[model samples]
Target chain A: MILAVAWRNIWRNKTRSLVILIAICLGLASGIFYMAFYKGMVVQRINTAIKTEASHIQVHHKEYLNNPDKKFVISNTDSTVQIIRSNEHVKAISSRVIINTMAQSAKTGTGVKITGINPEDEKQVTNLSTKLIEGTYFEEVKRNPIVIGEELANKLNVKLKSKVVVTLQDMQGNLTGAAFKVEGIFRTSNTAFDKASVFVRKSDISRIMQLDNQASHEIAILLDNNENLASTNTSLTEELSTLDVKTWREIMPEVSLVESSFGITMFVFIGIILLALLFGIINTMLMAVLERKKELGMLMAVGLNKTRVFTMILLETVMLSLVGGLFGIALGWLLTFYFGYQGIDLGTWSTAYESMGFDTLVYTQLPFYVSMQIALMVIVTGIIAAIYPATKALKLKPAEAIRIDL
Target chain B: MNVIEVKDLKKVYNSTEVKVNALNGIDLTIEKGEFTAIVGPSGSGKTTFLNMLGGLDSPTSGDINIGGTEIGKLSSSKLIDFRLQNIGFVFQAYNLIPVLTALENVEFIMQMQGVDKKQRQQRAKDLLIQVGLGDRINSRPSKLSGGQQQRVAVARALASKPTFVLADEPTANLDSKSTENLLSMMEELNKQEKITFIFSTHDQRVVNKAHRVITLEDGKIISDDRKNE
Candidate 1:
């Protein structure tokens, strides 16, 4: 009966109740939508980084990371590649001859990292062949063919088929220069990476540097299933203790920092929204209780104890909050899924986002756990908001309240 | 048995600058099944006396014994429980919970006592029928007439089978016809069911129907008269 009365009491002031309900609904929807947008952006950037720059995992000479100059190449590339390829989880693997060097055209010169990669393996591992903005990718060239980022090519004032000069130290510690034709111009999502990196055939660069067939600086791996990353890394770590095996998170700690911060930031945003809604709930419930002071007093007079009175008021507030929260979750879910399908395009801001390695189109995704978390948060907020008003309702003395005219 | 006993009951209203005596040095007693009226002029403390009898307010310096229990010695929560079990109250405004139906309002007291649903429902229906509101059991307070709401309030007060009911000007908001109807119905309940009823009112109609009338002047009872007994 008390439950029935509490439920009926909410509709006593239908306009006021509906207004607060709408406010709660809109607040939750906006908060959740913003969180989904940011989560989508973070996920997109991580995916782009994995696909374009770092594969799922990277292997380097144990000392190459500490001293990434010319002398620290991995010595047994074929054996290492063979062992890694035996793992079913390894989708693609490639060995690279990396050198810090300078590329020059007739007009200009700039510092860059020249990466010597096998065309076929690099295509599967990093998919560099698909990012061609102009020209062929290491194909149909008899001489030394190089693939340079569009940013770097523009900086050096070179284009496809333009002869560029590369200066670097050989394996014997002698500064050597070689002339190469730019066979491809690639533009990746990251402008900084595009500006400072170029790629060449590993055989061609290694022969010029007088290095053995086994010499390579880095081995990149792409996994068939991203979920197998930890197990595969642990297995590879045990299999090859001489090499340093690092996941993308370890290779790019800044990305991991951003990913973790996104979760915290999402909760903070929701907390702020819920806090604002908390005040509104408190105000509405306070009015509801105060307006019925006489009725509440009569309830007390008619044998309703303090505990039951308190429970009645609290139940009303909780019911109101849950009703509004469910509607808000449904609305937010609808909006997120609809936009997630169509994609929200940041057309004018693509360049700014691409510079930060984020994709222009954001696809919002709200996990089931996150939705459940929001439901729990809203219920807690309701409970907290009800406390002050319930206490006030319990404080009304039946003697004074019944006789008091208003 | 003496259902109510008051000895030198005193209630003083201490304001910022004045201390007015709302009830002054009153001694009263009433037996079971008595239809009594405490009649007084404005500011004569009739309402105060009723409030104290119903355990609604505490007297400044007095002892009130209701049905063998000293109400003044009980804690606030204990007093509320004692009142719920021992005394019923009917307000001038007929303060029924507006959201609840007439039947639910009558069942409210029994529900608070943790009575089973089947028993409370049948008892509430019989009581509503006794009050001539059986047909209006499902109507909310807002839908009922002023007299009907007051009858519902009476039924609710009697739902707990209290030792005595304290009515403070219950007919103040009713018309002459409704007032006559309510007073006679309450008189019937008093005589037929042996339900003790104590009222504080200035209404001549109520005072004429009461078997005993205690008139107060200046917060002190001046006359205790019994008629038609």
Candidate 2:
């Protein structure tokens, strides 16, 4: 009977219940949608960056990571190759010879980081070969030609077959280099890469830098399973007999730190939204309790007890929250799915995003737990919000309330 | 046996700056199976006295012993339980839970008394029929007439088979003819079921029909009269 009374009383004023429901629904949907979008963006960037910019692990001489210019060769190149070949998960290996050299066109000259690799193996590991736009790929030309970044090509105004001079410091600390024709212009979807990286053949670079019979600076390895990243890196280093190992995260602490901070930021934002909705629900439910004070008193006087009254009010609130939460989950799911499918075109900001190695379109898909979190938040808050109102109703003085007019 | 015994009872409602005495040092006793009426003008402390006797309000200092227990000393929750099991009430406003149907309202008190649904249903139906409301069992308070709603309230008061009932002007909202019908039904129940009834009101028809009458003035009893005796 107490439950019946509470149900009827709630319906007596429909407008108030509706207002509270709308607030809860919107809060729930916004929290779910925003979390999904931000997380999707992070995942997308990581996937693209891992696929195109860096491999699972890189093996280099300890000095290669720090000094970067030290061409001091490691011993047992064949033994290191044996270690790499022994791991079947090590799908591909692109040996790189990196040098900081000045490139000169007839009209311009600029400093560039040149990376030389085997054309077939490099393509198997990175997306660079597929990005060739205005010129022939590295596989097409055999004159030991250079593949320039799109931005570098623009700055130098040298298309395919254009003559450009390259200079580098030799073993004697003297500048030793040679001129080569421009084989291709490639853009890595990352402006930083397009402005800086210059690809050449490993043999050609060894001949230029006078390191015959020696492995290049680093061996960038791709693995079939990504979960082996840190472990493979360690094992590879242990087996290399002469080199150090590094995962991309270890080599780039700033990126990992940024990712961690973004997580904290998302948690904080969700906390505020949840707290606000919880209080809103409580305030609204308490007002309902107060307004029905006399009615509750009448029910008590008619023989209803505190426990029954408390249970009744709690049932109403929980039911309302479930309805509102389920609706919000459906709505939020739709909003996220629509955006994930069509994606947002950032054409105006494409260059800026590409500078960071992101595609022109941003697609966001929510994880399963994000929706669960939203549902869990609503349910927890709903139950918590009911406490005050139920307590007040249960504590109502039957005599005082029974005597109340109107 | 006396169903209600009030010995030197008092009640004080304390506010921020003043205390209002609703019931002041009074003594009264009412027997079982009696249709008694408490008569007074407005604000003469009749409602306060009734509330105390029904265990709805605590005495400032004294005893309200009903069914061998001094209700004034019992805890709040115990008092509520005692009231549900032992005393039924019919308020002046008809106080039927407006949301419930006539039958549901009647069954509510029985439910609180921990009666099973089947028994409660049967008892509620019989009481409603006794109150001449068999046809209006499913009607909500708003859908029923003032007399019919009062009938429902009366049915609810009797649903628990209490030792006694307190009716605080149960006919205040009824028409003159309907008031007569309601009083007759109460008198019939008092005689046939041996259910004790104490009505606190100023209505002449109620006062005359009751078997025992008590008049109050300024929170003190002025007269107590018996008709059949």
Candidate of highest lDDT = 1
Per residue, candidate 2 scores C-alpha lDDT tens digits across A66-90 of 7886465554455676679788688
Query: How does model 2 do on interface RMSD, in angstroms?
Result: 2.1
TM-score per candidate, chains pooled: 0.92, 0.86
**lDDT per model, in order?**
0.89, 0.80
Enumerate the candidates' DockQ scores in order: 0.62, 0.45
Q: What is the C-alpha lDDT profile of model 1 across B151-183, one tens digit per residue? A: 999999999999999888889899999999999
B3-29 per-residue lDDT for model 2 (tens digits): 888898888878657888777788988
- Model 1: runs farther than 4 Å from truth? A82-89, A136-143, A224-228
Q: Per-residue lDDT tens digits of candidate 1, residues A24-47?
A: 999998888888888888887788
Q: Candidate 2: where are CA atoms >4 Å away?
A: A1-9, A72-92, A170-174, A212-214, A223-243, A300-322, A355-360, A383-396, B14-20, B92-163, B176-192
Of the candidates shown, which would achieve the greatest DockQ relative to the real structure?
Answer: 1
Least well predicted 10-residue stretch by lDDT in candidate 1 chain A:
A397-406
DockQ score of candidate 2?
0.45
Model 1: colliding residue pairs: none
